[model samples]
Target: MRNDRTIKWLILLIPTLTIGLWEYIRHAFLLPYLSMELGNLLAPFIVLAVTLTLVRSLFARLEQSQQALQREKGTNAALEERERLARELHDGISQSLFLLAVKLDVLDEMKIDGPVKELATGLRETVRVMHEDVRQAIANLRLPPSPAAAAWVVPLRELLGETAEMSEAQADFSWSIPDVSLSDKEKVELHACLREALINVRKHANATKVLVVGEADGFGGFRCAVEDDGKGFSGDPLQSPGRFGLRMVRDRATAMGWNFLAERRGDWTIVELRKQGGAAS
Candidate 1:
């Protein structure tokens, strides 16, 4: 309504000012010629020029204002999305995980058969995965992109150590992440890839050790390798339903625009990732 009023005023002023200017010009300069018909003809061109200039200026300002408004709208939308995801994580998955934890604690106290215990353990792990997914979603929504120099080695090492201690199988783990930090996106993607690899080892590997190596690329990117000493598959991972872990890693790498490879080496399975460019700081 305010804009409409301003436009209306501008429209009214254009003709008023044009007529006033023409009368002044006629009295001031064209009075020597003293021809009313000549002033009438020139009057229209003056009014046209003035009107065009004012309209152009008004449109330019309106375009700038619109662009600014659009940018603000986008920012608000992003913030609202973050808040919604956070609320979902707290209300839904957090409560579910807490309930699962209580059930697992109860199972630990019960005198159950080996098969029943194993099934309980599997259910617990599934619930844990759901918890991790919710936490990741919340982090992605709430946290700003990590700086390029953010170090991921310490956290990765700690996570690997904790996983090894928690798993029942005899396992050995090694890593060589550089002393530098990774961006938030890189950290998230790398964690997802590593988690999938570890899950595969726990479920299907039937062997002992996992090795991880990471290094910084000269072009501000990074490369990582995850190798497991297990009974390796003989078929193409892309075509095998049993090779879901490899497919998941590949999909994650592809989504992040990174290079991914999974192949069997002798009796071992190797998965590699190469990020092409630095993520946002």
Candidate 2:
């Protein structure tokens, strides 16, 4: 504020001072050599030019600073929204999903039969998959806004490590890219997709070892691969049991113009997410 007042004063004073000095010089010194008529006509124009030179630079700098401050405020607002969203998801959807899963578990164990039993079983699996989806959603909401690739990838790595440990699976994590050039939206989707993949490996893949890889896709994009040496299943990604997470990941990838593929390579089941034409926003 003080700086603003000073700038305002400077802006007002520059023209006044320029005109005053010009008048004084014309009367005191240049009047005798130059004609009075010429001085009168040129004084205001000279003052205007001088004041413009002085004010232009200041205005330019002020404009730049204002733009920078606006950008910072925008970033802060986005982060705050993320934090609020995370809290709401955890407190509302996550808890609700947990409760639903518990109810489904009870239903699964009940002495029911016929179509109802099969429906209950299917619902149980669906709730389990949805529970994992809610977890990944919560994680994504809680993730910090990362400007650098390293910062963004660290959370994903930690998530995989934690999931692997919980599943008692040995994880070999490798990241060849120091940073990724992806938009914030892309980063969140990528992280969520990777987390879901790892969760699938943890819960369903009865695998003893998992190899997680993150690297450039060699086409101006990035790729995340989660390969598990588990008992591979055969079926369509969308129609298989315990495969809802894969479907969600695939849908997000498709919506974002990325690529998602799940296949058995040799003895390992590999899930790969690729983002082509990666660029930061």
Candidate 3:
């Protein structure tokens, strides 16, 4: 409405100014000019052109603003939907799969053999993978407003002791930080990597001993190492065809902006990770 009023005022002013100038020129020079009928006919066309240009410009600006607002609303809606799906997967599907895996494991232990036992074990492993995938999805959906860091002293002695019992191997775990705090995200990623490393050791490492170590470096970073007496590989990691486990470790490390190294030295293979900044402690 304001734009329309301004255009109307401009259109009226232009004809008024033109007529005043024509009259001044006619009186001062004593010259004949076009008849008033011709001037009257051109005035309406001039006013129409001016009004159309102004209205077109105003509408263009309005259209641009509307488009920008719509784009912003669409982006916000996508983020909210992603968050909602992540929450549901974490709270509902993950718990259900975990419980199902537990039940299958119990059934497998009751002298089951052949296809049924194999199927049960496979189902349990499948559920475990799904659970991990859901957790990773949730982690990826998180936004940049990070949670506050807190310190917790992970009881390395107790934790490692339990892990050793479960692995049924001679566990040689060491740590320098008796008390250290890590961000929740970092802690989750680190734990997942550790679990994968241990599983690899148990499944492929044909040795009687495994060593796990965690330490804080002086340069505001942390390092972890998992070494096993396994049959080490000789080829390049990227060129290897049956190295999915190593690929997963490398991918997780890359996602967290950490450095990962896996190499063989004689009969032992070592997987080392270095996180570049202090997480919480």
Best by lDDT: 2
Q: With candidate 2 superimposed using the best TM-score fit, by how many Å does residue 257's alpha carbon deviate from the native?
A: 2.2
lDDT of 1 at 19: 87
1-281: candidate 1 lDDT, tens digit per residue: 47756766776787788789789989998888868888888888888888788866776666676788887787788688888879888888788798888989899789997899998888887777667756756765686433345444444554555445545434444444453456556777888897677666655665566666777776677778767777767678778775777888998898888889888988779888987756542
Candidate 3: stretches off by over 4 Å: 1-168, 178-181, 237-239, 276-281
lDDT per residue as tens, model 3, 120-228: 8878776775676567557655552233332222323344444466566678867663234455566667766766676666555655668888887866678888887
After TM-score superposition, the amount by which residue 170's alpha carbon in candidate 2 deviates from its true location, in angstroms, is: 2.8
Clashes of each: 3, 0, 0
lDDT per residue, candidate 2, 16-119, as tens digits? 88888898988899977989789989987897788679877777766777788798999889889988888888889879878887887888788889999988
Badly placed stretches (over 4 Å) of model 1 are: 1-16, 51-54, 144-234, 238-281
Better of 1 and 3 by lDDT: 1
TM-score winner among the candidates?
2
Candidates 1 and 2 compared by lDDT, better number: 2
Alpha-carbon deviation at 32 in model 1, angstroms = 2.3
- State the lDDT at 40 in candidate 3: 61
